[model samples]
Target: MSQRDLAKHLGVSLGGVNYCVKALIDIGWIKAGNFARNEDKRVYAYLLTPKGIAEKAALTARFLRRKMDEYDALKAEIEQLQAELAADGR
Candidate 1:
């Protein structure tokens, strides 16, 4: 997305998006290039590099695992509480 679009989507300031994008570029995780347009002569576009794609996939997996773990724990706790309530009612 454009920097402004990223900022809005991320709930951050435009300048913060610019700074983070610059850092991503420097880290070689993302590539940046100029836009070829009349009014956007100096504007840039960005895309993830191979490394960045892999990192994103890995992070997504980690997030999914963590979320699953949270869900399972909640489920177990609820079941235990339900069992206790049943026992108390007997």
Candidate 2:
């Protein structure tokens, strides 16, 4: 998708998308190439490098672990509330 489309889809400003894309390119995570034979030279296709894929996987794992920890804490809180209610005969 075009940068404008990406920005709209992500609910961010166009400049925000451009900044992030540039950062990824600079870090060797993603490569941006013009679409061959496309009339518009401004159009680019962003592809993830192998390093990017690995980074994404690691990020996903961390996100899941954090969410699981949050879930466990919430479950414990709920159980404690239920126990308090039972003790109060509510």
Candidate 3:
């Protein structure tokens, strides 16, 4: 998608999208190439590099682990609250 489209879909400013794209490109994580959409139009296509793929996988794993920890903590807290209520004959 064009940068304008990306910005619209992400609900962010065009400049923010532009800056992020430039940063990714600089990091060698994503590459940008131009393609012809029509006789008079050119559009850029961004593709993730292998490094980017690995980075995404690592991030996903970390996110999942954090969420699981949060869930476990909440479950323990709820159980403790229930036990307290039982002790009080509620």
Candidate 4:
């Protein structure tokens, strides 16, 4: 997606999107290519490198694990509250 589109989707400023994209390119996680066919010479496409794919997978795994931990904590809290209510004969 274009940086403007990305900024809108993320609810962030255009400058923030540009900064992040530049950082990603600098880190070799993604590569930016010019689209000369487009009427606008400023148009470019960002493609993920192989390393980027691996990094994304790792990040996904970490996010899922964190969510699961949160779910378990919430479930435990709910069970504790239920037990307290039962003991109080509510």
Better of 1 and 3 by TM-score: 3
Cα lDDT of model 4 by residue, 36-77, tens digit: 788999999899999999999999999999999999999999
Worst 10 residues of 3 by lDDT: 35-44
Candidate 3 wrongly placed segments (more than 4 Å): 36-41
Task: Provide the overall lDDT of each model, using Cα atoms, as 2-decimal numbers.
Answer: 0.89, 0.95, 0.91, 0.95
**Against the true structure, what is each candidate's TM-score?**
0.83, 0.85, 0.85, 0.84
**When superposed on Cα atoms, how far off is each prediction in RMSD?**
1.9, 1.6, 1.7, 1.7
> Model 2, 13-83: lDDT tens per residue?
99999999999999989998997899988988899999999999999999999999999999999999999
Winner on lDDT between 3 and 4 is: 4
Model 2 spans with C-alpha error above 4 angstroms: none
In model 3, residue pairs whose N, Cα or C atoms come closer than 3 Å (at least 3 residues apart or on different chains), thus clashing, are: none
- Return whichever of 1 and 4 wins on lDDT: 4
| Per-residue lDDT over 2-77 for candidate 3, one digit per residue giving the tens place of the 0 to 100 score | 7899899999999999999999999988998876665545567799999989898999999999999999999999
lDDT at residue 87 of model 1 (Cα atoms): 94
After superposition, candidate 4 runs with Cα above 4 Å error: none
